[model samples]
Target: MRAALPGARTRPSARARRERTAGLAFISPWIFGFLVFTAWPILYSGYLSLTDYDVLTDPSFVGLDNYERMVGDPQVRLALWNTLQYTLLQVPLYVLVALALALLLHQAGRASGFFRTAFFVPKMTPPVAVGVLLLLLFNGEYGLVNEALGAVGIDGPSWTTDPDWIRPGLALVSLWSVGAAVVILLAALQDVPVELYDAARVDGAGWWRRTRTVTIPMISGALFFVTVVNTIAAFQMFTEAYSAYFGAGNSTYSNDAALFYVIYLFREGFAELHMGYASALAWLLFVVIMLVTAVQLLVSRRLVYYEGEQR
Candidate 1:
């Protein structure tokens, strides 16, 4: 049976080798783009974080000055708090809503394509439009939201006003464009083997158990991916806040209610021309995101079960 043919297993056919080469060659462009655009800036920013680089002047060595200021700067602390608040409040809301939507579409067993497209429509909308729409919806004076509240015998607060309600406004704005997340979770749900659900049912497991024992484990990777990605987005929240309240360069619109870490970094970096401080802000964000992700990974290992891993 061995070596029956002279050239058996001698070489991959020309087309097969070409296909492999072509695949690698095709992806090389993306690899180049990532290194040039992403890797360079990250490395550059880290270097700048250690120096005072005002665009007007050559970068002056500042050795830990930016980091020290970041620790003491009141606005830095405030921005960090705001970013964390966004992560805690919005990530859960977005991920849970996405999961719920994914599960609903998954269980519908019909019209899934329709529901998926419907849910994904929001992500396609321009962020500017979303900000304007939310502004109109949550506006206090003669806005649709206040009008609705008035009809229900309640008055809505001035959304862009009222420090206490500002975060809520941000969170509300966060929910509008979660279509990307929904699409992701939907894909994950699609891969959940239906046989597991049937087996759980046959074993007298209730809905909760089905989710815990079947759905969650199977989709845990997607969950982690969405969580980390959403957390990073939340930490970098700027568009909603900037467009709605603090446009181009009028400073922060309100009592810095919408002051996010990235927004602050932008102001400190470009507007105020504190390049070193802004770089410090960026690096602090990197550290915080890393720490938060590490913590989540640690905790998730306890709860995020992967399929076939013994409980």
Candidate 2:
């Protein structure tokens, strides 16, 4: 190694500078888009949350008034409760369905690819279409669901008309698009070491015991990811519920059971033109999601297993 002068500083060669410039040029579009479309909008919404703005007039500063109003709003409580119920009902069922599908496909050998694709096809369907499909399948009288129940000598509840069945019906409908989680979990399952299963088998572990002791722990990270993502999605549920119960032609159906947080936020912002209050609602949701995610992270430290992580 050659000794360098004490005061000398190294400079990038021409090639290095050119490569850096090229890299920056390649990412500039994404940087610009993030600033304009994502970052700016989030900052602006935060500012709007503290103001009183209806689209027609300029935003008037309101400090904590909007948030205070939320504290007293019965509809806010109702919406939050509905969302919580939906999250609790849907997330576990969704994970179980996705995991079941993933496990079945994992054993499918050469046919796994075909089955995986088939399962994922529904996930590509538009939310609006899914909402319409929900109405059709769960219609009070002539729907396919009730028809199938009738075949088994069971009576199906009026899913659309009855408020009591609405949340459960929506939760059931949400399972139709668990493909992404299935794919994630399937990938995680594939990554688990064959040696682990082999060891369990050698110890006379049965299928269920081996799965409980080996398979689940190996994929806990993926399970954690799916749970967090699904929870957030549940909280933000809007388009499907809106289209099913609140859309122009669907207004005849009962909406109280399906009045999710984001649907209420959408109604306040777009329908009633209470943009400021909607922004506050959005912020509150953001804070809640952040807190919930933080708690999940804390819990995951104990529950989630990572390969090569320090014990």
Return the top candidate by lDDT. Answer: 2
Q: How far is candidate 2 from the true structure (C-alpha RMSD, Å)?
A: 2.5
What are the per-residue Cα lDDT tens digits for candidate 1 across 77-133?
788787777678888888898888888888777798887888788787877777677
What's each prediction's TM-score?
Answer: 0.85, 0.93
Q: What is the C-alpha lDDT of each candidate?
A: 0.82, 0.94
Tens digit of per-residue lDDT, candidate 2, span 40-147: 999999999999999999999999999999999999999999999999899999999999999999999999999889889999999999999999999879999999
Candidate 2 contains a number of clashing pairs equal to 0
Best by TM-score: 2
What stretches of model 1 exceed 4 Å from their correct place?
1-26, 248-253, 308-311
lDDT, residue 278, model 1: 88
